[model samples]
Target: MDKIERIEIAVIGAGLGGAAAAALLDDAGFVAHTFEQAPGFDRLGAGIHIGPNVMKVFRQIGLEDELARIGSHPSHWFSRDGTTGEYLSEIPLGDYALKEYGAPYITIHRGDMHATQIARLDKSRLHFGFRLSDIVEQDDGVLLTFENGRKVLAGLVIGADGINSVIREKLLGAERPRFSGWIGHRALVDMNKLRSTGLDYERCVKWWWEQSRHIMAYATKSDGSEYYYVTGVPVDSWEHSESFVDSSREEMDAIFGGSHPMVQGLIDATESVTKWPFWNRDPMGLWSRGRLVMLGDACHPMRPHMAQGAGMAIEDAAVLTRCLTMTGVQDYATAFQLYENTRRARATKVQTISNANTWLKDPEDPAWVYAYDPMNVELN
Candidate 1:
C-alpha cells in the first residue's frame, strides 16, 4: 500500500473552485477531498468565457492542450449596440493573450469546462453527495458536519461552496448576499441557426449592450454550438427557482423583447427559459478563521462582466499550494496568513473591476483588468 500521509483538507462545494483547490492540494502531496451538495454533475448554465489567466493555471496543471482542443479560440472581444447593431470597440484576444499573458483566450460551454477539470482530477479524492451542513474550527483542525450526518476533521477547510455558502454562514454568521436586481436568461442554440441569422459566430465574443439590458453570445461546447445570455435589470427579488419557472414569457419578452432581432431570435430558440435574480458578494472582510479559509465565490463573489470568477479560483489554488509548500504546518498561522496576504489584494481587485465593467458603455482601454498576468509571479 502506498503510505498515505494524514494531511487532510476539506474543500466544501465541488464547483470549479472547490475542485481546483482539491486538485492543487493533491498535486502538492496532501490528502485533499471535496464535498459538493449537488448529488452529481449536471450540465447547467450556457457558456462562460475563459480568460488566459485561468488558462495559464491549466498549463501548469498539464491540461491546457486538452482544454484548448475542446474550446473555441476567439481572436478578440467586441462590443456593439443591441438595437442599432453598430460596432463600438474591440480588443485583440488570441496572439496577444499568448504573447503577453502566455496563454490563449477561449470560451467553452460552462458544463464542458467543468467536466474537463473534473475528469483531470483523481476520482478517489472526490466525495460526492457530502453536502455541508455546518462547520466549526477547533484548536487542531476544522470540524465539518455534513447533511449525511457524517463528520469530517481536517487540517484546513476551504469554502469554495459558492455565493450562498453554508460554510460562510457557519464561519461568519448568516448574512444575506446583495441582489444585483438582474434576471439572467441563458441558452445554447444550434450553430446552424446562429449562422443563418447572419451572426458572425467567430471574431471573438460579441456583446450587444443596450440601455437597460445586456445581451452577449458566443460559440461554445466541444463542437461550435453557440450560446446566448440576456440580463434585464431586475425590478424585484425572486424567492426561488420556482418563481423563475413561473415568470411569464410575455413579462420576460417585455424586458428583453425589443432589443434586437438577433437577440430576440436567440431567446426564441430556447425550448424553455429560466430566469433568476443574480446576487454576489463584494470581497468579504475575512477569508480565514482558525484552519478554515474561503476560496473563489465563497470569498469574493463578483459580477461576471470580467469573466474572472473561475480565474480567481485557479489562482487561489496556485497561491494556496505555494503557501503550504513554503510555510509548513509548524507555523500554520503564518502559512494561512501568507495565503491571505498573497491573494486578498488580487482577488479584491478582480471583484471590484468585474463589478465596475458592467457600466462602461465603451471602454477605451481595459484598465484594471487588461494588465493582469498570472504566470509572471511566483510566491516564494
Candidate 2:
C-alpha cells in the first residue's frame, strides 16, 4: 500500500491567488493543497490584464511561452476622451515590456489563465467544496476545520480566499469590504463585429475616460477575434452585489449614454454584460497572524483603476515562497514577518493610489509600476 503524503501547507480558496500560491509552493518543494469552497473548477467573470511585473513571475516559472501563445499582446495603452475620442496620452506595453521588463503585457480571459495554472497542479492535492470554518494554531502546525466538519492539520496556512475572506475575519477580526460607489459593467465582444466601426481595434488598448465615468476596450485574443470591454460609472448607491443576468440594452445605454461613437460601437458589439460593484479595503499595516498569513484580495483588495489586483497577489505568492525558502518553513514567524516586510509597503502604495485615482489617467511615468521585479526587489 502506498503512503499518502501529508500536505505541509493549506491554501484556503481556489481563485487566482490560491491556485497560484499552491503552484508556486509545490514547485519550490512544498506539499501544498488548495481548498476551495466551490465543488468544481470554473471561470470567474471577466478578462484580466497581466502586467510586466506579474509576467516576469510566469516567465521564471516556465509559463511565458504558453501565456504568450494564448493571450493578446497589445503594443500600447492609449487613453482618450470619452465623448470626443481625442488622444490624451499613450504608454508602451507589448515590446516595451518584453525588452525593458523581460516580459510582455498579456491579456486573457480569467478562466483561461486559471485553468492553465490549475492544470499544472496535481489534481489529487486539490480539495473542492471544503469551505473553511475555523483555524486553530498548534505548536507543530495549524488545525483547519471546514464547514463540512472535516479537520486538517497543516504546517502553514495562506489566506488567499479573496475579499470577504473567512480566514481574514477569523484571524484578523471582522473587516467589511468598502464599496467604492462605483459600478463596473464588463463584456467580451467579437472583434470582427467591432471592426466595421473604423476604430483601430489592433492599435492599442483604447481607454475613454470622463469625469466619474470611464470605459476601456482591448483585444483579448491573439488573432484579434474578441475584445474585452469595461465601463465604470459612479452610482448614487449600490445595493446590488456582483451578478451576470442579461441586462436590457436600455440599461447598458444608460451607463455609457453619451460616449463617443467609437466607444458606443464597442458597446453595441457586446452581447452580454456583467456588472460588479467595486469594493476595496482600508490599508492594513500587516497581514500576518502567527502561523497564518494572508495574500491577494484577502489582504489588500484594491480598486481596479490600476488593473493590478491579480498582479499584487501573484507577486505576493512569489515573494512569500522566497521568504519561506530563506527562513526555513519551521520558523514561520520569521518567514511571515519577512514576507510582510517585503510586501506591505508595495501593496499599500498600490491600494492607496488605485483608490485615490479611480480613473485611468495617463501616467507621467509608469515605470514605477511596470518595471518592478519582486525577485530583485529588496524587502523593505
Candidate 3:
C-alpha cells in the first residue's frame, strides 16, 4: 500500500479555510480531522462577501443552495470620496455580477457563513481547542503536538490556521505574520436601524475612500443586518510590525476620529468594536515542504483589500483536493509538489494584489481577483 492510497489528513484551524479544506477532503473519502485552537466557534466582527469564484467552489462542496438561502445578493458596488462622500462610480451586482462571472455574488454575516460550513460537516470530524504547538514531519507521516500535550499523527498535515499559524512555524521556520500597518475596525449593526435612516444598503458594497483611509459597508445575513469594516492605514509601519487585537472601542474611535461622518456614525453604532491588525506574506517559492504542507494564510497571508483572503483559501482547498485525487501518484512528495505547482502562481498573484496599497483604490483596476474559474484553469 502506498502513502497516498489510504491517508489520514490533519488540518489546523477552523476558520473559513480550514473548514473548507476539511469538507473537501471528507467528500473525497480521505480520513480527515480538523484541530481548531479556539475552545469554541465564535463569529467574527461582520459579514464576508463571497464572489462568483468562491461561490462556485461552495457549489462543488454541495452547499450552494444553502449558501444562497442564507446569503444576500447585493445589486451593485459604490465608490465614494472619503472626505465629501461624493459618488465616484458604481458597479452592478446580482444579475450583472452573475452574467459577468457565471455565479452570483453574495454577502452574509461571518457567523452565518460559519454556520453554513458547519451544517455541511459531520460533528465528529472537527476537534475544537486542539491548539497545535509543534509539528514534525517524518518519512512516514507528520506528527502534530498540541499546546495541551495531546498529539495527532497523520499522513498529511495542512496548516489552515490564520495569520498566526503554529504549523507554519514548523514547516517554514519561525516566520511572523507581518503587519500591513493598517488596522481594521469592524462591527455588525441592525438592518432595521439602517433602513429607518434611509441608507441604500443593497445597491452595493459602499466604500468611502480618503487619502489614507477607507470605509466599506454592506447589508448582510438576510438583509436584516449591516456589516461595516473600516481600514485606517498607518503612516509608518513595514512588514512584521506589531499589532493589537481585541482593541477597545475608544481606541477604534481615536483611530477614525476626524474622518467622515458616515464612517463615524457606523463606529458609534457599534458598542463593542474589535480591531484586526492586517498582515500578509510575499509569495514564497515553496508552499509544500514534505508530507507537511501549508494551506490558506499559512501559505500566503494577504490583506483583506480585495476580499480574497477567504476566497483564495477556498480555491486552495479545491485544488488540493484535485491533487489528492490524482491516480497512480503513490509518493506523497510527488503529490505535494504537484499541489504547490498548481497553486503557487495563482496564490502569488492574489497575495501581490492584496499586499498592494489598496487604500489607493484605483478605479482603473477592476478587481480581477474576484474573477477566477477553478474548473477551467489548470493549477499545475
Highest lDDT against the true fold, candidate: 2
lDDT of 1 at 115: 88
| Model 2: residue 51 alpha-carbon error in angstroms | 0.8
Q: Itemize residue pairs with steric clashes in candidate 1.
A: 181-234
Give all candidates' CA lDDT scores.
0.73, 0.81, 0.74
Q: What TM-score would every model get versus the actual structure?
A: 0.90, 0.94, 0.88
Q: 114 in model 3: Cα distance from truth in Å?
A: 1.5
For residues 1-380, could you state the per-residue lDDT of candidate 3 as single tens digits? 21222247888888898899889888888888888888877666677889888888898889877887777787877788877888886767789778887788888887888878977887798888888887767777777777877776788888898777777676567777666677676777766655454543554687878776777887775544565565655646543234445655577566666766777666666566656677767776667777777778888888887777888888888888777877322465677787788778877877887788552364543446556776455746
Candidate 1 positional error at 9, Å:
1.3
* TM-score, structure 3 vs. true: 0.88
RMSD of 3: 3.9
Q: What is the lDDT of residue 300 in candidate 2?
A: 93
The number of clashing residue pairs in model 1 is 1
lDDT (10s digit) by residue, model 1, range 218-305: 7775456665554545456766745355344465577777877877766555554566666767678888777777888888888777
Clashes of each: 1, 0, 4
